[model samples]
Target: MELRTRVVLQLAMATGAAASTLQMRWTTDAGACSSNGGQCNSLGPDGPWQAVMVTAGLENADSNSAAEVVDMPMWPAVGSISGVLTTSSGGEYNPFMSVSANKTGVRHDAFGPWLANLFINMTDEGPGYQEILRFKTSTDNSDELNATIVAAETWDIRMPTGAKYEAPAGFLGLGPSTAEDNKSIPPGLLDQLKAAGTITSNSFGLHMGSVALGQKGSLILGGYEQNRALGDVGVFELVNEVTRAFIVDLTLSVETGSSPFNQTGSMWKGVEGSEYGPDVTKNIGGVSGSAAILPSAVTPYIYLPPGNCEAVAEQLPVTFRQDLGLYTWNTEDPAYARIVNSPAYMGFVLADRTAQNITIKIPFKLLNLTLESPLVAEPTPYFPCKSVDSAYGVWQLGRAFLQGAFLGFNFEKSVMYMAQAPGPDMDQGVTRTLEVDDEVILSNAADTFEKTWRSQWTVLGGDETGSGEGGAETPNGSAPPAVGNDGQNAPGNKIGEAESANGDGETEENLGQVQEQGSLSVGAIAGVVVGVVAVLGLVASGLLFWRRRRRQAAKEDVPEKEWEAESASGVHFPGLGIKYEMYAPRVTHEAPGVELRHEMDGTGIGRRSMRISQDMYANRI
Candidate 1:
């Protein structure tokens, strides 16, 4: 049957008002990590991902809890979770870098301290102490499951002895396996969780909160949070590509007042021989759809082609701060007051195959971001908006895109569900509708619909005895779980709360309810305390990273008079080591001109620190 038709039928067959959904409340480090005399001071506007504390060691080696789990602020992306290991001999191994099967161990050194930790203690078989890399994966305060790791190495750094290690176990790899530009095979973390019955379905949800608003993001493993979603959910097909990234096509535009700043051309182009990129290669306007990857982990920004970047800047009444490589609005200008008062009135737009085009309102308060690092003596508040040249072949829709929308990933269906997030300026009347194919409907009618629905759950290992009141009745009671505004448990023992618990063998009857730390086990309390302390360090380290970037920005800051003189020079970010050259190409039928290139490369369903050592990468982040 067609996918939409099946979905409609499932909605009908599933007779539950109470959703059997798993929900995790998103929190921020701003409470504890603020350096402005304990006041609110966040580096980015939004960067909420699932994190947890974990221990790592070899599979067979004796484990040691004292193996220093250093509080190096490490927040892996929700979409991509892996580890960077430094062997005892100063070797670095990154399993996520493995694109081909035969690539057992390659050394990659493009990462900055922003991505690396100071060190990790080992039990002789750990990343820093052992000759090879391996880690035992388990989160802090909990031991629901333990998994082994197959070691993978970087291309630039090799083992001291030049001896090869075993191939990587390869779990939770969002990228395509084999790196031959093909689709991913089964056996991902989602598949494993489903197979183990940790979750009922292969669907997951994400809600990244605005950092400025003191909101936290959430990651739901089995189902989505209905309350968190402000508007109607829009489902879109994933680009049929071999890579596992969430690739999609979107048209770009902006609105300052009436007469919108409608751009024409592609925002991002796909690689040749790949099912990504713009429809027409060159002289692209923002109006045309362009293929781009929505990156969940990084900071907010729309990485666009040089031509498009120039167009956006020209239209917006903002200044280009060379030192920060950001666009800035004059605080003294009247427009700035309007921007601050009605930030929602000034926003961006993205169009895709779906009828409802996505629009996100960026508040002026969020734009006033400060770049403070250990390298910088003080904080520099440059508007965070930036337009990068997409020459580096990395066409990305970063956090900026997500701020306006809520995205869900269905690994089972290989599709991404998107919907405009609720906002102050959103058009309340805007909506999208889809009608199931008539042929499928007629065919479905031919069969016993009720019997078919009953049998479907039966095949899914449901109890099939009864459907309950206040929700759909099912044999197994696997109805969709309801989400509360507080983001706590559903009505009853709804999710994996019955199964997962602390090492003490206690299950939380109130799955959505989180009590005070005093009520939790010693391990849970310790995890919370450790997280608070480490987050402070993370904020401190982030400031240091910003300082380092400031130094680089100072060295390359160019004036308008010197623009022609320095046009040929590339702007290099010290800490990140990425070199960007600004270039604007005229509209053309060929490929869009290039601007920024990425030199360095960088889930999920939780909030904790996970140890992968050098041997194993955490399967779930």
Candidate 2:
């Protein structure tokens, strides 16, 4: 079998290049970026919210990129303090110097050989929840934070052993929650940061720039930028009525320029109870959704209801690529310009249930995206839009919608503030940190917001945009790490969750790892082989069963209304939990039956094999 490699095109924001310097390239190939693409800079001379070139995993203040630049989103987790602490002095916490794991396969590139010496030890305490702070190396001492905080909880952490390039750094999460047993575990990172005195306030500002416009957005820890906001900051109450995600009431409308849909309706508008065209007047809750989930870590895709999704597909001239499970535009079509460059806009409105509520408008530049992947040969333009099929519970407002607004979350106040984001050329902004002495912004914001609500939400218009899809430029194809329970926070953020090019089970994370020496006992080897075969067979049978079930449903002509009614009653959403492997090497046991050995194969890379049982002392409520 021939291994057909796909080109992971470097989209605009994903590369963090200046607009004039922007160009597509393979995900594994190195470009002419400085210091191997790590953001390196000092604290004093930097502009406000300026770009820093510090990559992940460097112990020293000033060090070049240790591994190729890849993007991975990571979060901080707080541990429970109610129980007596038991110290398991198994692995000493050093400065965490060097590249410990590269499970995502960037370790195979030109920089792979250099990664081994950078930092190669990862202490695997093994499954179940534990606190961990995976901080990246910064260029300076003062601005670079080094404080003792609770470790963030994670499931299935992939610490790939090989030097395969991944993000130089992971994202610092501001959310205060975690996913456990299909439910949200609270007191996330925000609580930890506050306890450690990392910030004076519980709020953090985010400005993920539009690479197409050469905008430089920055993450303001513990605060936000002043002048970069285009309007009054719209404060909203964070509701936990749905999933643990950030949810807001929103309506979606798409403008297809001078397309036929625009002939009768200027844009296809789907709101609660207003029928515009042939499409049914789905409620904004049905069209856009009741609780729109805003995830910063994953790529931006507008996951909508099936009715709204169909309305969008009908509005544009797109061919549905079944293999890729996405809609592609015909660039050669004369109507293409109307779809991509029309002065009109596609609007996503963030509004409240009341007649008078805060509204934030998202434009077309933020919606119509240009996507290219190693999975696809050329740059294919598509809307980062999808549907919940027949479901109607949680809608996701991804990176595309965020690009149009500056999002600030204050976990302390349980409120969210959003403002229209200013262009790069608009203003030089000042930074403000939340002080403990200061009053809660949400309280004051709510008092003021009561008088500001208008019956209708505003629609933002523009042509300036970001990349074709919802992701930040990361070295190892990782997305901007945000608070997520699912393992989809790594690279390939917006890419569909389908099989790879050869329809094989292998993916970017599972594809490559540098294997070193290892040996397994006869019993161990037999157990492993049997396990693999059993798993594969089970998976195949389960998939076949699912497909047959789906076929039967289609033949039965089940009314869409049935799912809608069921969804209205609330879907039993077991929190999304995907498994990812973390490969670790170099382990020695001082005692018998407490062995930590590397499971090695022909490739010589290593997988940590543990033969010890952990005593469960504390249980978090």
Candidate 3:
């Protein structure tokens, strides 16, 4: 059955429709612009181009919560801003701002001095209290790129009073304005900028820089950085406008010298030898029909069908942890170090709308990310792949995949563009501007940088000559320049550094060394009091349960089934059961002038209901 399904998918991809074109221009000779803050003149003659720095830092400069600040690296692409929230009662307070992952969910206070402002009744804007605030991207008073946006004044997660809320900081929502739930939502940052004629269209580009290289990323409004993307651009249409989903047919494969399995033959039954490598290569297979690219997801995972995820898991030394809903890497295994340090990569081939194929290769180093503190007892290496039930009819690629892929959205044209992004060391400061109605062409040339991992790094046990094992064959049988894990040249050969838009000759601080400190604020003191009260209540309840248990007979405890918590915005923990809510009739948030919809009639048979649920889930935002 699996073989038959694979054949059908291959046939469908071969006969797909022609790809779409985007209007844009690419240039590498323009003046360099500061990614931290300033006008990106490199974006060409486009007017009012703003560059927002993507840093792995705390959004609130005054936050002193040591336990939470350590998790900043997990949430990169945090755009920085300072803004004031004003209440209807003439109260005002400044709040820290960061990029929001929840497309339409409300922003809340996690750790900062903004807690007091969150409870104040702001001027109502329909479904919730909202206020308009002007924010500057940098501390520079002279920067004219400041933006005004509407923000939600309530918390998305309503925690019981006296319980320490683990909510995230204030967020800047960039979801599509055309979404059904967002119809009444005030215009987002992008929409407001377009309305004021600050930008030609409601379009943006993003490159979540490498966590391994400790590189800072860029979020460009109005255009993209041409240097970041390499090779040809794969254009995909927004299949579901409500979800802003970009779906594509994709295949996955991995190449490595050290095979995890003892068997020598290929694991995939009908996969062609030409499509993969020798016995060392593993064909991880592809999605049944299509997969969604969810760039805004809060978690960093690549959700795939159960069978496909297991296929990839078989190639690595990993074990699934039910508690965390993630695959924890076995660091004690020698193969773990060999696979991550050696020149191995898992490649993804996506079919564009034009029937053209573009491959994005992610090195093993990037896939070997770490989870620390609250997520786990200690820092643990983890594999980002998660299995989803086939019944849902939808799989997604999240932020982890974006580390090596550049995403560009053209809302006006209802088109999305993607390409392989270069590492920080390979950037050349090239940029492109996509103006309204301009014709943009994609290059058909080969990738400017090396795509094969073997061509860049040396394998540990490989031959010293670099020709036979763990190395790519070269004309002169010589090894390429070796690079350290930090993206710097090793002692043997030195590579030239490309000029960057930031113009900072120094390398960024490593993820482990990056830290921010601030004294406790009013919010922290209030949180301490709430925490003490909650602890006392828990202790008193525990004593009562202990006395009752002593009087009863001892009994074997049953193992609890694994479960995941779903948020109001529909973001679920990985590897959870299907959400039946997608099929149920539901009403929008209670507000003025919004009507309730009863779409599900409970009159269908079993199979018919299942089919309807799958269809509805696929279309859900």
Which portions of model 1 miss their true places by more than 4 Å?
A: 1-65, 68-81, 84-186, 239-293, 315-317, 332-334, 345-348, 351-356, 360-365, 374-376, 392-394, 423-621
Please, what are the lDDT tens digits per residue for candidate 1 over residues 147-247? 22223233121111232232111112222122325233223344444556645555565545455454445455555544334433444444321112323
lDDT of 2 by residue, 1-621 (tens): 112211222232343222111111111222212333422221100011112222223343346633322222221111211100012211112222323321211111111110111111211121112223322211111122222221111111112233221122122334554343533233444455465665555656665555444455545546666544554455555543111232224433333212222212322223322112112112222224233344342223455433454455554555555443345665554444543443334444444322223444454444556654333556567655543321112234545556556666655665556666653354534556654443233212222211221211122233211112353211112223322344334335443333222225453233232122235566765665576567677778999998898788879997767755654443432122222212111111111111111211111222221110001101110
Better of 1 and 3 by TM-score: 3
Worst 10 residues of 2 by lDDT: 612-621
The digit string of per-residue lDDT tens for model 3 on 357-411 reads 6777666667787765445557788877655432223334655677677777666
lDDT score at residue 133, model 2, on the 0-100 scale? 31
lDDT of each: 0.33, 0.35, 0.40
**What ranges in model 3 sit over 4 Å off?**
1-127, 133-171, 179-186, 239-289, 390-392, 438-446, 451-456, 460-621
Model 2, residue 598: distance off in Å is 41
Q: How many clashing residue pairs appear in each of the predictions shown?
A: 67, 53, 5
Stretches off by above 4 angstroms in model 2 are 1-171, 177-198, 239-292, 353-358, 390-392, 435-621
lDDT of 1: 0.33
